[model samples]
Target: MSQRHVLQVFEQYQKARTSSCQTVAELANRPQNVETLQNAGVMSLLRPLLLDVVPTIQQTAALALGRLANFNDDLAEAVVKGDILPQLVYSLAEQNRFYKKAAAFVLRAVAKHSPHHAQAVVDCGALDTLVICLEDFDPGVKESAAWALGYIARHNAELSQAVVDAGAVPLLVLCIQEPEIALKRIAASTLSDISKHSSELAQTVVDAGSIAHLAQMILNPDEKLKRQVLSALSQIAKHSVDLAEMVVEAEIFPIVLTCLKDTDEYVKKNTATLIREIAKHTPELAQLIVNAGGIAAVIDCIGSCKGNIRLPGIMMLGYVAAHTENLAMAVIVSKGVPQLAICLADEPEHHIKAASAWALGQIGRHTPDHARAVALANVLPRLLSLYMDAESSEDLQVKAKKALKNILQKCTHLPALEPLLHDAPPNILKHVVGQFSKVLPHDSKARRLFVTSGGLKKIQEISAEPGSLLQEYINTINNCYPEEIVRYYSPGFSQTLLERVDQYQPVI
Candidate 1:
């Protein structure tokens, strides 16, 4: 019940060569007893018991210390300070399977507490020991070792490299495909953590033939395993287009599509994220995802409960829209314009707002009607707000400004158009004049409004150059303008004057 009582029991158990040591060790494994043992500085007492001649004493002692170390930073520091790592590392090769397993379990708990704890384990040469145990004959030892390696590699780049250099990757890949479903899951998770450290480490795993294994594993219907495998693939795909192409080559797209239909929220969310990364590199590649019905699934995620899910969904939709005119139209017809407007106006994340704004511009850039639709959503003000915000990132400002230019250029709304046209670029002027040409024929009010606003003079000036591309637009204006007005504005081309010139023509 008291710390001194547990310590005295531990001392008595250490001396006895009977099952009494096992009983005391099991008592120490109890939560209440472990707390007493830990608070009383029993690690020094337990350290020698880790290598006790009896397997149960060693197992129980290791298990008890591991339980205490998992509680908090101070306990873990105490476990490391008690110099338990070298004994744990040595125990991996022990003749008793339980000793190896218990040591690995304790080591995993210690290493997972913090990077410093993990580095301490590494400093004691746990990485190399663990890599050997990855190939152990006992499934329990192999699984424990693999799990421990994953925790070490979670945040330690050097340990990850050390693990990889010691040849952990291919073995882990082998473990993933084995019949033990639990081990396969742990190996898959470890591989994901390993790949997260760097592209070079990820590429090492990929180069060792993990992609095909991962692709097959993805179809296994294990929700947690699927999440980990997808995350690893995403990390790999993010580094280079060539590797992304490899993911496609493995026919991973269909599996990814299937994952989008998973019941698990994380699986669905991560699937959208991976597609977003793959779609970013090239339009051709993006089209593959769209062709696989990724657009509709991703559009649905725009309203996901989680912001992380929703943000990537909005971002993926934007990237997909940027790829093609038809895809952009697909987004518009899916009611994506209003959804994007919402993200721009109300989404708290500036990058999400920026992505939504850019997507709106892409959608509207295809035609005038699309631009008008986006502007009609009252998104113009929000876009202007983002573009002008001093606190907005440069990328956000740049996206907002481009979207504004696009919407304003194609917008038929007078208030939106007039300001833009007064300072329109040459190409934008062409689009504006083109819009006017379409409306002037059916509406006399439009014709008069155009002529009175110096639009006629602008057209005439455009027509002055014979070889200009605007010649056709100028010709349309000449055809559309009333005959009296044309003659008044351009007496040089009068029919009577042309007839007089024909009568005075020289003969050959």
Candidate 2:
């Protein structure tokens, strides 16, 4: 690792080139030694060894350069600038499986740092060699080649299209069906990376018959494989309704729901995310999950996980509830509001809390029973508090305000609203006062309390613009009371005194 130690590894007569190369590779494997080895100009030494007459020496030198590059971007660029990639790519077609694996690894390590480095590998014609390597008798070379292509494709749409042009998708699909779990996991992940960039890219993967092959792995006992498989499905399903329908047609549900209960948190998270993507497309698609009991399973997933893990499940509930009143009721009936309420109240993250508030509004905005369900869960007051908090981000404030406006317009429960009058800003107060105007006029007891509890006085205190809707609401409430009480509650005096005259009696 030290400069002195690196020189000793290359003392050509003291140790065979193979032994020296292997020593450096092993030492570089320890992350702490990577920088020291690089600073000693080990890249300069490893450059020639990449083409050594002994194949193992070439393999180990590539392995050492890869370990150094894998440590950070600087070394990755060093590999690119060291002129090692052309040799590595050149050797891929000719080397034995072990040498090919090490060379492919060097490319993957170099490429993973950034698109610039990946593009450098492609400029040297690594893709054609890698694509051919995909068919090699050795599965190790195939897996390594797959990883390099995946890393290249991940950086941008142009690069992903490039990988597609090289015809990696069908081969990747083949890798997905292979017997090795690691190969399946990486293959699935690469498909996800490839499909995520654009609809065209996703359609390419689908055309390769990836959906059924991927669907078969949904319940695979390997948690890591299941995560990638779910993630890949989520990516493909995200592009369009037709694509989502194709995923659904696989009959992978009910069983996909079982993944929601997986012990691996990522599997659970990705499962929820996959369901979220599908349900977002259509009411009928959402209904599939509901029929499969997705609502209860997702709520349990939300309840069991925390932080970002809960986000997709929370949104799954929102998407389902957002589709229709019946679906919303399904969420409510499944005890979703309290879980959402808990997220809104307790989660430290603003975005998750914002999601919870928005979902609650969707659930509550439908009808009085729905609004009452949200009300009973103590959700509105908390939503109001989030809206009023100055520290909340503008996005959070916007979502909270929209949720409030939507829910309060449908809310008929008055006790839940009384506290809002003191705290709501002018915009929200209009809804609260309007709810009061609707109820107090019909219930004598509420009308009496509106006066006795100083509710009328609170209405009088609001500085509503003369012709605004708030002023109109005040006039309507004044008609509910005797003219004297109306005049007494008026801010100063009122032309509305005559507006209230219908309630007056025995006037001269």
Candidate 3:
């Protein structure tokens, strides 16, 4: 078949396939005919047909090529490597909304398949054309253009820089401010992608003072827009620490806190995750979280949230507890212990359980009083019970044992330590003994616990015949705690403990 003849056949097929009267079922059964045309180099020959088609045919051709984009790279390459790109660019200048959207879809496919094609599209002035589509009266066209620009910016840095140079930021910022939630979402996402490659663009976004507007969107009546804003903030926070600080300083915490109560699981989950990222970098912001009454909101989420939200919430609270002693105390005072304890009790997800255990340890570390508070909450007994339960996995058992050890260590001064020491279950005692023996000299409190509690007596009894227990305990103490703590009180105590351990090789 001649190239010209094949092109004619492809055009005929294209005309037949695009008719609104033609059923998709009819097109589906005609693969043989389609293959005959394709085998005759139809895609290669149809490049010119792309340029001459009316808006309807151009749209039809663009949609067909988008579908064929994944199936055959040759057709996609032909479309992009040929004058079809200029035609697509020209289509964007048209007033017809459908043609503009179709043109944007084709550009998206081209950008997805080939970075070179994306560059080519950009060189064809596609960026300026698409940016104008942001103002198009048709929302669908705006959405398609926003999506296409996002992909283009993600794949091509120069194109992204060009988009930023073309004043795309203000337009995108306007899109984010749009009353239409969907358009705002796509615009925010596109802005996020642009910001990743160009910090200048991120600064541009920040300069537009979009953070406050974004925070308002988080409280928007549309739940979908709230989610989009939260997600965008997460992305922005990842790139710019200044923007992150601004997010906190803007008092966006309350908005995010409210999102925790949203009925949509995705909204709550994303809000929790955003809160975690925000809290992790700016530990000082944990106080802001507390000030906004986020603790109760986050704690409330633990009961009904799925693992997605629950784990991050657990992790964030743990982060807060670790950073701020006062916040940790407040969490305990606000009854956060019971919620976390119950989550550990009822939620079987390992990561969730791990986070809970970690948060409990943080609480234990912050204040001995708070540690005793959790112990009094009865979480220790349940954690200890994990050791004996046949259903518990080894990982869960380890976490449970670790948390129990922290609880015990913290509560050593509390009266509850007496019962835990004497009436405590056997497995609990074994874990405590194992932990005590492993205590490093740097861990003064643990060393202190070993010395103050009956750990010293237990070591003495075990080492009575050989004295190896004393050496092992001494060696562990010298190695584990921080150098500063050891230096402050012990001086060369670390070396002395190791020397004593080395001198005697008695077996326990």
Best by lDDT: 2
lDDT value for model 3 = 0.69
Highest TM-score model number: 2
Question: Pairing residues by index, what is the TM-score of model 3?
Answer: 0.68
- The true-structure Cα RMSD of candidate 2 reads 5.8
lDDT of 2 by residue, 415-487 (tens): 7877787788989999988888788779888888778777887777778889999888878888889998876
Winner by TM-score between candidate 3 and candidate 1: 1
1-508: candidate 1 lDDT, tens digit per residue: 9999999998776567335445545666566776676666677867888777777778878876777677667778998888888988877776477878878888888888898998898899888888888888888888998999898889767878877887899999999878887788889888888887777888998988999998887777778888888887887787778878988898986657877767788887778778988888888888888787777767766655445556767777778777777777777777788888877887777787887888888777767677777777778777776777889999999998888777766666543443334545465556656665566667777667767776665566543356555566567767887777776666455687778888996888
What are the candidates' C-alpha RMSDs?
Answer: 10.9, 5.8, 10.6
- Candidate 2 has an lDDT of 0.89
Question: Total backbone clashes of model 3?
Answer: 6
TM-score for each candidate, following the candidate numbering: 0.71, 0.90, 0.68
Question: Sorted on lDDT, highest at the top, how do the candidates line up?
Answer: 2, 1, 3
Better of 2 and 3 by TM-score: 2
What TM-score does candidate 1 reach?
0.71
Q: In candidate 2, residue 311 scores what lDDT?
A: 94
Error of 3 at 379 (Å): 5.9
| Clashing residue pair totals per candidate (backbone < 3 A) | 0, 0, 6
